[model samples]
Target: MRTKNFVLILLSSLSVLTFLDRNAISIAGHRITEELHLSESQFGWILTAFTLSYGLLEIPMGLWGDRSGEKRIITRIVATWSLLTALTGLATGFVSLFATRFIFGAGEAGAYPNTAIAIRKWFPLQERAKAQAFVWMASRLGGALAPLLIVPLQMQFGWRVTFFVLGGVGLAWVLVWHRLYPSESPLQDNTDQQQYVAPENDAPRWTVHLKDRNFWFLLVMYYCYACGVFFFISWLPKYLQAGRMIAEKDLSYSAALPFLLAAGGCLLGGWLSDHLVSRIGLNWGRKLVPVVGLSLSALLMLGCVAVDSNVAAVIMLALGLATMDVTAPVSWAIAIELAGKASGAVTGAMNTAGLLGGTIASLGVGYLISWTGSYDVPLIILAIQLLIGAFFASQLKVSTPRALDKT
Candidate 1:
């Protein structure tokens, strides 16, 4: 394979590693809560701790990656998070676990922004959405695999040992990444000149993005999208086993199905976005896929709430998640399209908003369930949030250079 493609594959693997680490906690949620003697709300706070720190640290990490180089930043990220993931297994109570998860979130904060920067530096604009698709698909694959993998390990070795094992997997990836990933582009002077390697421009400041209206819209849209998606990653497993009373034997398969379905959604979203851009022009191409996808996602989520059978409900939830994910790559592409050279900073800002949404959703769902005695209310709220995201997506100005100024 070409070196650039090789780099893409490695970076994509990092994406998978990230989701595996992040989702592992949720996959082992039942065991953790039982061991710690924690209430549902307290467990929710544990998840929130991670997301809050992840959101708050995103911009700094993104800026650092942009200035210092993603290779070094990514190296630090993997090492820190891996160590923290191991420490997570050592937590004795709520405070210790929350602190560990918060720091772990900080460690993992800049991963995707750095990945976006790497994509911006390495791939052509036309191919970026598809590249992002592969990265997200890998993440979904990791998420899909997490329940299937973690549950069996937890059943065999206990949850603490299962976490220790997951931590080791990341450390191994770090060794390969440090050795193989080149900081500079391998295909710099090739025929892919359309892939603008954003020139260094110290003149225009990063604050320019703050004043851009479209940037805020993108941020809001991403925030809403993340709220809906976060519910699945942070709460789905427990929601299946607890809220819906799914059998433990069925929990792993049920939890994994949505993400597995979402893997296909990412590929479809990427292909559709690229195809539409070529045939109908960027205006409709970029906006249409997300608009349609998120809208359908909203409808499907509502279906999840309305269904009677646990099996039918899980299937609806899986379809809803897949539909929502169809917009994931497109959203990242919009960030890259709007930010240009500062893809890291802009995408980081957008992700910050998104994770903030995730933080809120994580905390809220716990209380929402505790208060209401069911998942129905929270699911309805998330469905409404997806609709709001679709509205923002429809308003995006992707075709014009007017969305961003040339630095």
Candidate 2:
């Protein structure tokens, strides 16, 4: 096979491992809480620790990838996080678990942003969104797989052992990646000339993005969107058990359903966005999916809450997550378009905003559950956030950068 295709496969594998390790904690959350004697609010703090450190380190890690190279940085990230993932199995209590996950987040912070940089380097403009879709689709595949794998493994061997196995899986991926990934970026002979690749001296300064109104709009849009999407990652298993009253035996399938549909949504969104870009142009093409998808998802979230039947609620919740995910690949594509040569830094900033939103959702859900004693309110609030994101996505004014003009 071609070298770029091989790179894409490796990158997609990394995406899968990233989410598998991430979702394992939530899948085993109930077991962990029971074993460790933790409260709802305390568990939220554990989740928050990861996101806070992850957000804090995202830009710095992305900048490292930008200045140095993604291959070296990504290798380090996976190795550190994988070791931390193993150490999580050894946590004695809340404090130890919190510290381990926080450092793990810092280790894993720049993963996708660096993957974005790799995509920018290896794929052409037209293919980038589809490439991003495949990567994200792999992540959802991991999410879907996590509950199926973790529930059984934890049931048999225990939660701690499940983490150790996952950590080993990540280390295995790192070794393969180090061995097979090209030392330099693959030739981009077929890449779009209209795409900007600024020289070392001419690269856009970080301050330039600060002045771009569209950049701020993108940040706000992603922040709101993350608040909604993170529910699947951080709380879905607990919600399935406590809120919907799903049995432990049924939890894996129920939780897996949403991510399976989300994988399809990523593909549909990427294909639709690319088709629209060909027909309408960049601004409207990129704008429409996020606006429509998020708006529809907000309504589905409300429907999930209003429905009386547990089955109906699960279906609605699954569809809501799937619809919201339809915006994921398109959003990354827009970040690349706006980034000039700073794909790593720009995507990093966007994801940092997302991690902040995820942090809020993780913490807020725990505290709100304690206060109100219902998960429904948090779902409603998240729906509102999605609506807010759709509004910002509508207002975004996207244009091809002037730097691309000369090419």
Candidate 3:
């Protein structure tokens, strides 16, 4: 239990570093834009570069995690993304920065899917949601904490040096992850007695997974969700400076408000989902939380557009993000459970689709802003996607074996 908890902490820390490194660009977006002599649309293209690559590669990397050991793949991914992030410091032009960031996104594409596979490997059914929540919260916490850390660092060092330092931190984590993770699954460990008692299998093939209807539905839900999230990740800083006319100092902490709230939602959702599942059973556990979460999320999203002040807008955004996060753990939890021994592969596919959604949302929102010259217009579009997400999540059919319901 202690070691598993340690592993969780490490996973969470890495996620924090990932968000910190990525979001650092947002914190420095104003300066970067001026330094590079960039047009607003060109800046959008910079983010699109990363989003496009990240979305395209999520599934392939996730599948690799499923087939190759999660520990190994995750460690390598951390190393790879960190290296690319560091290279971002060396970029002198929009094209150079875009390429580096895009490559960084590709390396990061499988992080959550791999984390899902790790949870499936290490945690029991009863604890999976909490474990996933821990994972999700850590990532959010990283984002929340970024302004505190990265903003100060960027101020002290130039923004470029900040990226280099953040990248170095990731390299350190890779060493630790590689050291801690065992070569084989913990279930297969001779020291442990818990047998997952593997589900009955019929000569495993990728085709069996590819044919499932539930899988596609989940994919659709994730894609929609990703669109909303990517919008936040890509546009929040600009939104603060442009949309709200916030000062850089306030922008640092205020930008984090939504993420801080989201951290709580991530934990709350995970803990609640697991408890509900344990009490009710898989069908109810799997379906109930997501339906309610996505529905409420849609309402809150629409609320985000209605707010007049930056304070109100971000607070509403926080609530909207929290409501959506309420189902996040369950989403990944279902993917791993349904995947069984193939957790990595299925999770990867779901994430891949989500990334595509993120890519579309990122680019689409930018174009909306460019065309309409108002953040609210693009945000309205995002709200509509959330509505669709709610519908998809409500109708989702998660396939878990009846016998495993109590597990």
Candidate 4:
């Protein structure tokens, strides 16, 4: 295989490992909650701990990736998170599990931003959305497979054992990543003394990103997007089992359904986004998909409440998730287009916004359940956020990164 394609595969594999470790908890939540004797609200806090730390640390770690290199930073990230994933299995109570998840989130913070850097470095501008789609599809694949894999494993061995096994998988990937991935460093060997400039020539001052109005627009848009989509990541399974009262034997398959459709959405969205960009133009091509997709997602989220059958509701919710995901590649592509050489930092900022949204959704779902004893209220709130996101998506304009323009 070609070198870049191989690297893409490795990056995709890393994305899989990352999602697998992250999603395992949700699938196994019933066992964990029962074993630990956690209330729904407390369980929400556990999920929030991961996302809260993940959001807060994304910029620093993404900046580090830009300055240092993905080779070093990714290795450390995988290793640290792997250790924490194992430690998660060892948690004897609420506080310990929450702490482990928080640290794990910190370690995993910059993963996608760094993946953006790798995509920018390896692929041409036109191909970025497709490459990003490929990477994100891997993420959905991991999420889709988690319930299918974890449920059976948890039944056989227990949630703790399942976590330990997942942790080992990450460590194995780190060893492979260290050996196979080429240098992402912009610096040349010291003996030759020739400078290896980053894509924008030199890295721009971080303040440039801070002051850009477009950056804030994209961040808020992403925040809205994250709030809606993360519902599946952290709480969907529990919602199905607890809220919808799905049978344990069938819960894994039903939970896997949304992520499976979402995986297809990423691929379709990526291909369509690239086609639109090539055929029409960036403004229409890049911006329109997200607006349309998010709007549909919003409608579907609301539709879920009207359905009476548990099976029908699950399908509607799955479609809602799938439609929302269709915009993901476009969002990431804009981050690259807007940031250029600072793709890592820019993507990081966007992801940080999204994770903060995730954090809120995580905690809010629990509180809403506690307050009203119904999942319908939380679903309605998320639907409104999706509509708000669609408006923000419409406002985004694709252009050269300010840093690149200055140079």
TM-scores vs. true structure, each candidate? 0.96, 0.95, 0.93, 0.94
Per-residue CA lDDT of model 2 for 301-373, tens digit only, reads: 9999899998888889888988999889999988887885688998999999999999999999999999999
lDDT of 2 at 39: 93
Model 1 weakest 10-residue run by lDDT: 194-203
Stretches of candidate 3 off by over 4 Å are: 189-204, 401-407
lDDT of 1: 0.88
- Higher-lDDT candidate among 2 and 3? 2
Error of 1 at 15 (Å): 0.9
Pick out the ten consecutive residues of candidate 3 with the lowest summed lDDT.
Answer: 197-206
lDDT of 4 by residue, 1-407 (tens): 27778989999999888888989888888899999999999999999999999999999999999899878899999999998998899999899999999999998889999889888777766788899899888888988999999999989998899889988989999999999998743222222323322234354665586777778888988999899878999998898998898988898889999999998888888889999988998777888888988899989988888888988898898899888998888899988888877888899999999999999999999999998999899999999999999898898777655434353
Considering every candidate listed, which one attains the maximal lDDT?
2
lDDT of 3: 0.77
Assess the local accuracy of residue 237 in candidate 4 as a C-alpha lDDT between 0 and 100: 88
Itemize residue pairs with steric clashes in candidate 4: none
In model 4, how large is the Cα lDDT of residue 346?
Answer: 91
Model 4: residues >4 Å from true position, as ranges?
184-206, 402-407
Q: Give residue 102's lDDT in candidate 1 (0 to 100).
A: 95
